[model samples]
Structure formats: C-alpha cells, structure tokens
Target: MWEATLPSSRHYQIFGYPRVQTPPPLNKRRVCLRFACPSDLQSRLTMRRRASLRTLLAACLAVHVGCYVVERGDTRVNNHVLREQNLVLEERAENSVHSLIKVTESTSTTIPAPQCVLPPGMAEEIQGYQEVVDRVIDYVTTGDFKGQVYSHLANLVDTFGPRMTGTGELEAAIDWMVEQSIAENLDNVHTEDVQVPHWVRNNESAWMTLPRLKQLHIMGLGSSVGTPPQGITADVLVVKSFDELKKQGLKAAGKIVVFNPTWESYGVTVQYRSQGASEAAKVGAVAALVVSITPFSIASPHTGQQYYSVENKIPVASVTLEDAAMMERMQARGQNITVKLIMGAKNYPDTISRNTVAEILGTHQPKETVLVSGHLDSWDVTQGAMDDGGGMMMSWAALVVMRKLNIRPRRTVRAVLWTGEEQGLHGGIEYFKRHQHDHEQFQLIMESDSGTFTPQGISFSGTPEATCIMEEVLKLFHRINATQLTNPMTGGPDIAVWEKLGVPTGERHLARGLYYSYLTNLLHILNELFFYVFLALHY
Candidate 1:
C-alpha cells in the first residue's frame, strides 16, 4: 500500500510502489509468494541466475525485524517493501517490527517495523516534607530575613554598577560575596577559577545619513565586532524578519541590514539580536542593525549577546524602537535610507573569572548536593540588577536564611554565584568540567537566571518518576499559590551542561516578556518568597 526504501549501504531493494507481477525466465529462480487471503493473491519475486541470498540479519537487529534481501533489476540499493497486511508510515516503519520473519534462499515474504514512544499527582514521600516547607515559607515571608533580599540587592547594585565578565568590578563583587558568605558562618566558602570572554563597549554610535542627518540611539550587542576607524557608512536594507531578509538577500550585499521584528514573546523575537548579524553576513551584508528586542520601548535600546559566523564576522548593534520603526517607514515610502555605524567595541584575550561558592553542609548526607545557582555577571548596559541580580541575590539569600535559622537539608545546599554566564556559560562549563566526575553526587541542579518574576512554578526536565516527585513538592506551595511545574521548552541555557549529562535540572519559569518593566520594578514580594519554597522543595 506504501513505498519505502532502505539505506544504500545495505544490499537489498524493496519496493511497494507500482505493484505488478512480472514474468521471469526459467534460467533464473522465481519465488512464488502466495498469500492465504479471503480469496487468494500471489506475487513474483525475481532473483538472479545464481539468486544467492546474503545479509547479516543478526547484524541488523535481533527481535521482531524481518530482514530480507530483495534485489530489483540490477539495483543493489537497500529499500523497505510494505507488507500486505497493513500500511505504515515510512518514518515509523523502521522502529517497530510487528512480525518476526526473514527471506532466505527459501520462499518467504513479510516485513514489519513498529515505533515506540503528566503531571502532578503528588507522591506520599513528598507529603512528608510539609512541615519543613511551611517553615521555609514563614521564614522567607515574615521572619528575620523577610525584606533583606531588597537591601542586599540594592547594596550589590550600588556597590558594583555592571558586573560584566572579565572585569575588575565583577571580581570585587565575587570577593565581597565570598567574605559575606564566610561572615554568615556558611561552611566551605571558596571560588572556582574559570576563563571568560572580555569585550569592552565604548563610543558606540549610529546616525541616519541618507534620509536625514538624525542621530540614532543604539546599543552594541555583546561580543559584536567594532567598525573600522573611519566607521561603516552604507545604505540600509530593512527587513521585518529573517524570512524577508532571505527573500531580498541579493539587495543586502554591502548594505547594513536592519531587523525590525514585531512585538512577540522574547523567545520568538530575540532571534534577531542573537543571530541577525551572522545571518545577514551570510547574505553578504556588510553589517547588521537589529531593533531593540523589547516589545515596548521608551526610546531605549536593549542589548544581548550575538554570535558571529566565523566566515564573515560583521558589526552588529541594536537601535531604539523609535529609530528602527522610523527607518522602516522611510523605506516603505521608497526613500533611500542610509546610516553610519561607529562602534569602538574591542575583544581582549580570554581572562580569568571566579565562580563564588558558599555552602550549608547537610546534617546527614554531606556528600550529596542540592545545588542552587544564578549567574553573577551581566551585560554591560546598566547595573545588571533584574536580569540576574535578583536571581543571584535570591539564591544567596536562601543560603543566608537557612544559615540564620540554623536549618540544613538532608543534602548539602550549595549556592553557586556563577561568573561569565552572560557572555556565554564560561564559568558554568568550567565548573561542570571540574565536577562532572561527581555528577552522581549532584542530587539536583537549580538555576534562576531569568528575572525573579511572579513565580508560577519550576521549569524542569527529568524522568517521569522525578516529575511526579517534583509535582508533589510543588503542591506544598499552595499557601503561596506558586505551584505549577512546566517545561521551559526553548529556554534553559545556563544549566544546559548538566542537563545533558543526565543530571536532574530545574530553572525558575517566570512570567517573562515583561523584562523591560520587571527590571525597574524590583519590590516583587511573591517573586522573593517563591525562591525560598523552590530551594526547600529540591531538598
């Protein structure tokens, strides 16, 4: 009923298409395949004069797969022929073998392949942690460390404006955290040395030249290359999305391609900032300009990391919403829009950075760890407060609260403030390399790199059993109304290293897409309280 083919590396040609019985010479062997049907059916399988069968059926697969060597004409290609009983999708046919039969020098004809492929009913084991969860919620909400997250974060922001990776100020911030961890009587406070990228931004500017001499507001994407000494002045080629750029790629050569994607979720829209430059350069674009990633902008341009395609590393930066929109409008009116981009950004040799580690040793299982982390480094635009500051301080505050209450989990609760997470996962990767051999001891790896927005639940990936246990733990947070576990389908970059190594991982799933506003509104009471519950649930 359907047609499928095996790989060329095999020595068989199976086909169900153009089904017909073809006559063969007596000199060659013709196998008569008679089906025991309601009526009767027959098929002729022609073989060579020597019609010798050769195939490693055991080498293919053991169980139900019916390995066959069917040669059509002189073609020795490998193909899969459908069985007479039922029709199956070609893709799913190879995985599931319904019948166990093979075609040898004898008469036999049968092939079958079959393919094999949710949430919170809280377990009783998790039901036992109710008392401990309640105490954690109370301590974070109304106890001694009630409002200290803000004060601590404020001091961190005021002390170090932007803790970008490979910077002196960032190292000082790590040192301060180390001293503070030791001051809190947390045991085994130290740092893990790692190398991180260093890209400095200075004198970055953009100006509209062809349409008018209007200055444009711009922010260079992290790791973007700087324009030459004289700057890059070229006509602007505006495109709404990557698709449009691809359609009109011929017009992009030697021009500055501008991406002005409409307001969508950050996950959908930030592609321009992350990959616009490399994509544009592929089409011969001399440089790329992306409209700020924010859905709503008050004349401010947002900047994030942009990776370069080694073949053509071009300059890339973000322009304010107002300017990018205006440029698009001018282009629609058939006006020739041109702009000059000047970036003094420079990349230095990789420098050393430290991941600050402070732990509260467990009372029973000291070797096993419930690891909580947040990136300490940030983009060099502002004080880097909300993006990760809130997450980092919240992580540190959890450790501080447990220490203050003289409480410890069954496993070691370790708070790791990772460095160089913004540029890439430099510090996190190095830390993983150092402790990958000890993956078994890592009971859980948790990170909240996203803004500590109104807590919905945990973003997690693990076995079904693990998911059931975590859902039961989430139910314990019903009092605070922040208990829903969802998978971060597209996100979870920070802890990707451990997730691949089969370690159980969790990231805070916030009500994202309001990052531009959430950064300024730092007094989120629920966001702060949910963190404590998250920490306790993992233990």
Candidate 2:
C-alpha cells in the first residue's frame, strides 16, 4: 500500500502519506476542505471529484492514520451534511513528514487545529526513542569535541601554517589529516591524489611615494604577475567601481587604478577583488589595487585569487581598507597621490595533492553513503580557521562522535577532507570525475566549509520531499534550535559536482558570529556534532 503525492516541481516521488480521494458531490456545492498538514494536499486535490464519499473517508484514514485527529461534523459549512471525519496522521514508519495542521473549511469548524503531534507509537516506544536521542545529545555536548578539534586545528595551523594549493604545506596537512583520522579510529582512512596549480605570492609591498610618505599594508593577489625590479611608480586613479574606471577611458592609462567600492555583502563586494585587476588592465592601467574584502579590517590586507587577461596581465594586489579610503580622500581634496608597487608574485608548474577520505561502514547498506566533508586547503596568508578550518574539524568530530556512540547508520557515512578548495575546488572536481559513476549510491553530500559558529539550520538542495523529511528529522533537535530548513539547498563548491548529478546535498548553517570568530570560537563544534548525531540516528 505504498502511495505518496509530491510537489509538482520535482521529478521524483517519495512514499509517505496516502493519496487523498475526493468525495462525490453530495449536492451541487462540493465543499473542498483543504488540509495543510501534509504540505502536498494541493497537488493531491486534483483527483478529488472522482471518488465516492465513503472512499474519500477511507483514503483519508489510511493516509493520515496516526498523525492527525479529525472530529465529527468538522467540515459543516453552507448547509452541507458533514458526518464523522477521521484525522489521519502520515505514518513515521515509512516517511516522517512534519507539517502544521491547517484546515481550510468552506464554512468553519468548532474544533481548534492541533498544534503538535507525535507519530503512531506506544507511549513506551515514544519514550524509548526520546531517551536514545537525549543520550546521544548529552554524550556529544558533554564530550570534549571542541577542545580536541581546536587543539588539532591549532596544531595544523601552527605546524603547516598556510595550505596554499600545490605547496608542501598543503600536502603535509593532508597527510596529517589522514593520521588524525586513523587516530580517531575512523575506518578506511586514505588520500586520493589531486593535481592543483601553484601560485606563489613572494615579497610584496606598496607605499605612497607622493602626497604623504606612508607605507601601505598590502598582500599581493594570488596568481598576479610581478613588476620590474625598479617597481611601478604611477599617479593613483581612484574609482568606486569598474563602471567609473571605464568612464575614465584613456585617463586610466599609465596610472595605478585603485578601487574603493562600498561594502555591501561578501558576494557583492568580493567581485571587485576577483575582477578588479583585469578590468583595470583593460583600461591600460599599469597596476591595480583593491580594498581588502573584509568590511572591517585591522590593517590586514585580505589576499585572494584574481583572474588576468592574457594580453592585459599586470601587477595586482589587495591594500588595507584604510589605505584605499585614504587614497580616495586624497583624490576628493584634488591632491595628486602616487604609489610605488613592487611584487614577486608568480605562477609555477602544477603540483599533485590529495583529498583525505575516511568512512564508517553502514550496518545495513554499506555501499550507499552519506557524505560529510570540508575543504582542507586555505589561502596563503590567514590560518584559514574561520574560512573553513572550523568546518573541517566539525566534520571530523561528527565521525568521531558517531564512532564513540557505537552507532552505525543504515548507510555508510564517509568523511572527505578536501584539498585545493581555495584554489577553486580542484580536489572536489577530481573526486567527482573518478567516482561519478556511483553517484546514485550517494544518499546525501553534506559540506560545512562555510564556518562553524553556531548551528542555525541546514540548507537543502533537493526535492520538497527531501526537505519534508529533513524538517521532520530536525524536530528531534528542537532543544538545540537547529530544526529550520530552507528550500533549494544549493550546497557548497565541493559538492557542486555531485549536486549536478541529482544527488541531494546540504550544508550546515552556522550563525553570523562564526563568520568573524571562526577558529577562535569553540561553540560551533558542539552544534555541528549535534547535527551529525541527528543524521546518524535518523537519516
């Protein structure tokens, strides 16, 4: 008796609630009672006028068995004879659907809608499940996951420092992650080789040679070319955006283009950093300088990769926000500003790296996998803590906690620590190329490379049916306030390959605080562990 109705946008269907059968017209006015608990009633309502009243009642009973409770004469509206109606709950034995009970009656119902519900189970059975979840949460929260994760992360940062792609540090860090996986008792720990580009940012510096003598803090953008030994000294042409630079036309020629775009959001402002160089070079600028990507900076220039035109390649670097603003102020006062820029940044040959992978075999279906992961590589400067270090350790801790709890899910849970993420998801791309044949076996691919501050919810990238299941699963963690689910889960870069293959993917949503204080903050690790435990017990 497997029957289910799905949202129209999706191509697949999930078996859960039974299909609704519309009652035959008692009279001319067929009062349509739309129930909103199942979240898929609208789609199922298309067949309402085809069935008899008795069949409709039977279908409702079978579909919503223990999840809902309907009272007799609940649908009496406009002089319609409403007899006994049963509130059927979508059974959790097959599909867990958590939805609000919203009854749209043509007239009105005297009974109030139910606020909360439990799936059909004996009191003892319900309590038993609750106790197990409670224990899992307690064990994970009380454990030293944060300390262990941070300590290991600190060691990686302190030992290997920057894991820029194609560097020895990145390779060493990958090896160390494998060793840590073994130490944590994770199964099948190994590294898969991935070739990545080598872009080095050697000695770099910027200074105001005119209008005021002051050395500006700067970090050469990755993959940028260097200037001559004498360096380029040119008058600074300040612009708020590429559009303004374009308007300058030939005026930008033989000048150092400096951009001071207002901070909006990372997605919006970071574009200037990514494309500022080529845009400047297109206008015949000798060199390009962009303000740091961070909205607020403490004299630290945030370094990132920038694309360059083959014929228009020129030196480009990131200047501190203060310096960029100072130059803009100087230009406003009609004062000429000249800067001396020198950089040894260069691109070398490609090098080989690896993605660290470990797995816990499933108790039931070992071939199917629930993939949890984060990138192991980072930018060349910062310790890469907040950017993704916290995310990496959080994933590692999930596997450790699952092992500690002696819980093996129905499918294998594989933890992949990716390399070359900062270098443009090269590691993830290679892995997908090698394993794309088995994409169907991937039940889910979860990435946490954003930041691990505090758990908010998960962003899902699958059908509404998957979202419904995730929403219901999250209810168990109401105590932690991490049950929220957003649609079109469009996941992170590492799993983008899998997402294109139609495999459902997701990423843990963390609070805004973690974005700033990522590695330094320890609160998010526990939240991540709680999320993982939930996946283990339920999904």
Candidate 3:
C-alpha cells in the first residue's frame, strides 16, 4: 500500500491550466490519498518522505510507472499509464460527491456512430401482399384458439419432467408432437433419427468445512468430471476474474478455485462457468466452482455445460448466488476457508433420438420450404416448460392454426421440433447433414427458443431486400404491437445454423419477464410466432 497525503494548505495549478483554490473541509483541513498495488508487487516500492507533494508523486511513479491506483476517501479512480503523457489531471466539483472527470492522452478523439439508412422502394414492394398481411393480423388477434395452445403445452411439460437427450421422456415428447401434427391434419409429418450424447448426473454435493460448517447448494455442470469416491477437500481460492487468478499463480495450486464474478449479461458471465475449470486446472487447482449465471435466484443454482482441456481435466460445478457471495466475503476478510465437493456425474455411449417434422405443403411451389422450429431438449433440473417447452408448443401451434384457417401459401410451411439441443446442437447438425441436398430450397427460417413471454415483435436477419419485405409484413400486425423491425437480427440456435445457406432467419421477441407456471400466458407468443411464420411463407 502506498499513501499520499495532500495537506489543505497546499494549492495546486495544473500544467498549462489556471490555478484553482482548494475548498476547505467542514471539520478537518486534511485529505489523504491512498493507492494499492497487487499483493505480489507491493514489496517493490516503499513509502518515503519528500519535500513537496509533487515530489512524493514523482517518487511513487518512478518505482512502477503504471502500477499504482489512486483512491480518495475510499472512492477508487482508474490507474493510468504515464508512459506517453507526462501529466494526468482529475477534476472534481465542490459540492458533488461523485462527479469525476479524467483527462488522458487517448481521450482526444470522439467516436462516430454507424449509419442506418433505409433503402428506397420499400412501401412499393409491400403492396404486393397487402391483402394476405391483413388476413394474418386479423386471424391471429381475433382467433379463439388460445385454450388449445395452453392446454397442449401444460400436458407436455407436466407429463415429461425433463427432456434430456436420448432419454425415454424426450423420445415420448417427440412421438407426442408427431401425433399432434397428424391430428391437426398437417401434411408430410415424419421423424428423422439422430444420435445424441448421453451424460447423466446421479448425485452431487458441496459443503464448507472451515470458518463455519455449512452446506452449499450446488449442481454439477453438464459433462463435468466427477470427483473421487472420497471427494475433494481443499482450501478455497476466491477470484473475481481470470486475471486475478493469473496474478495468484502458484498460490492457487492445491486449492479449489471459486469464481465469484459480478453479474454482467448471461453471454458474458456464462464464459466463466464454461471455461473456469480448464483455466483453473492449468494452474494445478484441484477443482472449480462458479457462481450461477442467472441474474437473480433464491437459493437456486443454475447448471450448464463445461468444456475441459484434453491434458488438464478437473471437476466443475455451479453454486447458488448466496453461497458464492458468502465464500467471497469470507475470503476478503482474510478468513481461511475450505470446501468439500462430491459429484457422481458420468457420460455414457451415444443414444438414438429423432427430430420431429411436420409440414403444410404449398399449392404453387412445393419445393420451396419456409421453416419454423424450436428445440425439444432442456436442462435436467426443472420441468423445462419455459426453457423450450413453450417454444416448441408455439411453433407447433403455428402450423395447426394455419391448417384450421384453411390458409395455403405459395411456399411450403414446415415446423420442426428438434432434440439434443441442450447438450449441444446435435439434432440440428444431424438434420442439416441429412438434408444438405435441399438446403438451396429453403426460403426462410425462424425459431422460437427464447421463451413464451408477452409478444413484443420479431428480430430478423437477412439481406436488405428481405429486411424491407419483413418490415412491410410486420406492419400489418400494428394492432397487436408487433411491428418493430430491427436490422441487426438475432434468432435461436437452430435457425442460426441456416444462416450459412444464405437463408433469412428470424426469432420472436418477448417482453422482459420470467417463466411463470401458467400455460395461458404463452398464448400470446403462439399467436405472434404463428403470424410471423405465416408471413414468411407467403411473402
């Protein structure tokens, strides 16, 4: 730790700037500035006296130019490298507590925003399918098919607890989907067999053995190696980031690395869970435990897959938000903590599964297919009603609704319920490999795996012409508030695979909310997905 004290008596003037008067403190006329370096690097510099405050800073910067971080009254400021620029200035308002402005060499330029100019002749192209668009909007909004979609989804999830790949329940769900399609009078209903990896989690447990004995809620990551029969009992090393772990170096060896990173987004935080084990193993750690990637939880530990290095494999698991926070706080207080973890997870040989497909053949162009799909597999913990059960139902109900309405498009409308999506994209990969010859015939592809929340709009990914067509098609659903068309498109994993074939892909957007245990709430999503896929087929 390096400490620099700025006495109130000293007034300062910045380089090539006007002199400023110091504001007097209400009580004491003294202010102290403190900076800390990494523990391993703290021994390189010693706090020493100087004739003036400027001289003291010069001495601190002389030891390690870019190592020191300045803090005032417990408020941290970013550390800067003074290699190129000799002067760094910080300004603070007199009455405001948190107002800070930092001037550096790289802050001289301003970044420009990207252009998003729309092309011409969009409204003219939209007039071609004006009548069909109006019909789709009217049918989706005023249809009395809500109860059918809800009841079907509830029955599926309540019957099949978890639809893991290659499991009997997943196969049963696939068969049920096929039967429902046949009952709905959907044409070309069939199933394509796909081999999927089978990994089972028999049992898992974790407990804190030091500082205070406590049981931690944990779930073994998918495909993670299990501990020995005796279990792994080692001291806990808490790190907020991989960079912090690198700084520890050999100090992390022979310990259980617990990653307690702050919540960013799911895409950002999930990397820690997926790669934390291999990174820890490289440093000779016994095992790795990561905080769940979810933003909020009540003693709930979310589980996902973890990949291991071929040379350094180690056990990995996810702990609840509460347990991770507790262990991190204990470590920050300099308390010695140890954890014992036991997992009985193992992987077996690949098992046979299938992807369920149903189609409504086109009257004009039978070979041109407009595809809509959602994964049929999910994590093994919950009922999977929200993860993809709802998405599957949404896609299935789309074709059923079209059949009931006696609406036939110029291109075939296809609905596929995929399997083995949770473990990876096995079902989708197998489908593409088996049907690569027909790839050029695919007109448009969309999937609904996000969730079944209140429908907002659609996200489209395609060329400028396709985008303008989709924009005009969505305008018909203005009554339902689903007309927002964004250029930067995002869709589910299954549809993302079709982008390689230059097919236009899309996903239904939902209002920000969680999965409630109700089937009725998902009816809106069913209507939106049905309408979007209908327009994709016709246009």
Candidate 4:
C-alpha cells in the first residue's frame, strides 16, 4: 500500500496540475539523492546527516520539472507518458519511506479530453426508425407473445431442468430450440458444433471433524479435482483474503484453506471462489473452500466454475456463508478447525456441443450481421431458470417478433443459443474462432447473461461513435422505461471476445431477481428484452 503523496495545492503551485493533499510526516533518516534533476539543483542534493524528507521535497519543487501536473495523491490518475519512460516512484530500501517520484514529459497529449465524439447527424439518422421501433414494442407487447412469452420460458425451464454443459439434457434443449427456429421458418436455422469441456459432479460430501462435528453444506466448483475414495481429512486454515494467506505463509501447508471474504459485491468477492484453490495451492495447501459468492444466502452453498493452473491444481468447493463464518469464528478463538471433503467430480475430454443459430437475412446489407445471443448451459445445481433462460427466450423472441411482424431488417439479425457458458464461454469462444475471418461483417454483438427479469436497459462497450449510435437506438425503448444506457467495464463474458475487435457489445442489465428463483417479473421484461433485441437490428 505505497502512497505517492505531494504537498497540497494551497501551499504549493504545480503549474498545470490538479490539487493534491500534503504527504504525511516522513521519518528523519540520512539518505543521498542520485536522481535526474536540473544541474543547478543537483549540486545541492547530497547526503546530509539526519536530513528530513522535507528538504528533498523542497529541492524538487525548486526545479518544477514540467507544466504537466500529476496529482500524486490520486494514484488512480494514470500518466502513461511517465510509464512509457520507465519513470516511477522507487523506494530506496526496505522500511524507508524515502523515495523519488520521477515525472517526465512527452509532446503528445497526456490526458485525452472528455468528449463524446459522435458521428454528425447520427441521432437524426437513428430517429428515422422510431415508427418501426414502436411497432416492435407493440407486436411483442400485444400481438403474438404478449401474455404467452413468460409461459413459454416457464415451460422451457420446467421441462428441461438443469441444462449442464456436455449433458444430454442441454443437447436436448438445443434440439428443441432448433426445431422451434425451423418451425418459425427463420432462414439459416442451423447448429454449429462446439467442443466443450465435460465436468461431472457426482455424489460429493463434506463435514466438520473438529471443533464440534457437523455436516457442512457444500457444492464443488466446476472443473474441480475429486478427492480420493478415502477423501481428504485435514486441519482448515481460514483466511479472509489472498493477502491474509500470504501473511500466514507456510501455515497453510498441508491444510485446507477456507476463504470467508466479507461481501464486497459479486465481481470483487467471486475471485476467491474462482481462483482461491490455485492461490491456496501456491502456499502448499491441499484444498480450498470458499464462502458462497452472494450478498445474502440461506443455509445453502453456491457453485461456479474454477480455473486451476497446470502446476497448482487443487480441489475447490463452496461452503455456505453460515459454515464459513462458523469456521472463521472457531479459528479466531484459537480453536483448531478440521474438515473432511470428498468429491466425485471428474473432468473428461472435450465433447461435441451445438450453438443454435437462426437468422433473418437482411433486405439491404445481407452480409452484415447484428447478433443477439444467450447461453443455453447452466450449473448442475438447479434449473437455470433465471441464470440465462430469460435471455435465451428474449433473443429467440427477437427473431420470432420480426418474423411474425414481417419486419425484414437491413442488416441480418441472428439469434444464437450458445452452449457451455458455465464452463467458461466455450460456445462463444468457438463462435469467435469460426467467425473471426469475417469479423468486420458483425456490426454489433450482444448477450443477456445477467438475469433478465426486472429489466433496466443495457450496459454497452464500444467506440464513441458506436456508443453514440447505441444511445440513440435506446431512445426507442423509453416508452417502456427501458431506455437507460450505461458504459460498463464489459458487457458480458459470452459476447466479450468480439468487443476486443472493436465490435460494439451490449449486455442487458436487470435491477433484481435471484439466479435460483423460478418466479420472474415477466411480461414487462419480455416487452423490454423483445423490444431491446428487435430494435437493435435497425442499426
């Protein structure tokens, strides 16, 4: 946690720099400065017996290196020019705050101006299709699907329970979607083969063996290694973070690392579940157990995919928050915690799966494409009703509404029901590999991996031009209160690969809904999603 601090703006002037806070008091230590500085100031910079850090700062201030100000107090402000020159604030030695902040100059602009460089008349161009967008909303809300869309989703999830990747059930679900696409008479209704990993979680169990024995609720993470038939019985070393594990160091050796990270949003905390095993194994830990990645939890464990390094593979699973906290308390009280975990999880060779694709050929630019897709795969824990079932239905419904309403788009509107998303986006990756040769043809890519119930609009990532166009397109959804647009770090993992190649990507955002809940705030959501998808084709 090093801080590069500088004097406050009130006391010192940094020419063109932003305001910054004063650095904390530095220890009075004898040190010599041998850094690049003005020749006149360099002579005054020398080792003085018991010289304070203040003297050094005053010397650097005299030079006023450049007009470009770096707010040292704000570490978040990146000056790439300094980085490119290998300039850094290097601490002289251990236990010494004595350091130097090297700032240099480059002719190019250090910081880009904050401006939305939209193409001229882009908004007006998108507004031209307002009438068509209205028709899409009307058709999905009152025409064919209106009240029956939710029922269709309910039937799909209810009929095909958990559609785990590489499972026959998932393949069956894919077949059903293909049949439905054909039944709807969508052109190019076909399936592309995707080879996906097969990780099976057969009967697994875990229980406490020390500090009062009790059965522990657990779910093995995807692709986790299975314990031997006799199982792994070892003392548990509870840690709240990877930093704590590093502090404990060798204490984790031959132990089961239990992670009980405090809730800090799913994006921040889920890392413990995904990479805790490898991190634990790095310290010679035999296995890792992470608290379920959720803000609120019943006495149930959650499961997600975990990646293991080739050299540091270890068994990993999720324990309920209750159990993780219980272990945390036991360890804090100087009680030795021990647990026995036995999992029958196995990873087989990658097998063939299919990504269902259906398209409405364009009326004008037939070769150009606007793809909307969602994963058909789910974790084996329960029926993935809300995980992505709604997304799948909505993407499919986009094609359905366009077909039923006889709205042929200028660019091809393709709906892909991706498989093996839970196993780390195998379907989407395969799609990218197969279509990358014609990458320019794809104008926009979107996915709804986030729960689709309680719709709020979409999060997007794109060039300023693309973002401006998307914002205008979203205006068409304002009637349903779903026109909000946000720029996120990413849209979603499935469509994320294409975003790298400068293709605009959008991820539908929802305000609420649990992944396991079967009850969805339907009908209205269908209005948003169906309208969201169908209208995107107009781009």
CA RMSD of all predictions = 15.7, 14.6, 13.7, 12.8
The number of clashing residue pairs in each candidate reads 6, 9, 0, 0
Off by over 4 Å in 2: 1-132, 144-146, 513-530, 533-539
Give the C-alpha miss distance for residue 476 in model 3, angstroms: 1.1
Which of candidates 3 and 4 is the stronger one according to TM-score?
Answer: 4
Cα deviation of 433, candidate 1, in Å = 1.8
Considering only N, C-alpha and C atoms within 3 Å, which residue pairs clash in candidate 1? 5-79, 6-78, 6-79, 96-113, 96-114, 97-114
Model 2 residue 447 distance off true place after TM-score fit, in angstroms: 0.7
Against the true structure, candidate 1 reaches a TM-score of 0.75
Task: List runs of model 4 lying over 4 Å from the truth.
Answer: 1-122, 310-312, 513-530, 533-539
lDDT of every predicted structure (CA atoms): 0.68, 0.66, 0.67, 0.68
Write candidate 3's Cα lDDT for 1-539 as tens digits.
12223223222111110111132222122323233433332212223332222222221212223323222221111211121112222222222111122222222211111222345765555555556656655565565664566678778877876888758888888888888889999999999999988889888899999988999999888888889988999999999877899989698999999998765345446778988999999888999999987757678888777877657788999998899999999998999999999998888999999999999898899899888888888777766767787788878777887787787877899998988888878888898888867888888877887777666666666776676566666766666676655333443676676766777888885553333213222333343334663453363
How well does each candidate superpose onto the true structure, as a TM-score?
A: 0.75, 0.74, 0.75, 0.77
> In angstroms, how far off is 48's CA in candidate 2?
32
Q: On TM-score, who's better, 2 or 3?
A: 3
| Candidate whose TM-score is highest | 4
Per-residue lDDT of 284-400 in model 2, one digit per residue for the tens?
999999998765777878777777665779899999889999999999999999999999888899888898999888888889998888988888876776667778877877788
Better of 3 and 4 by lDDT: 4
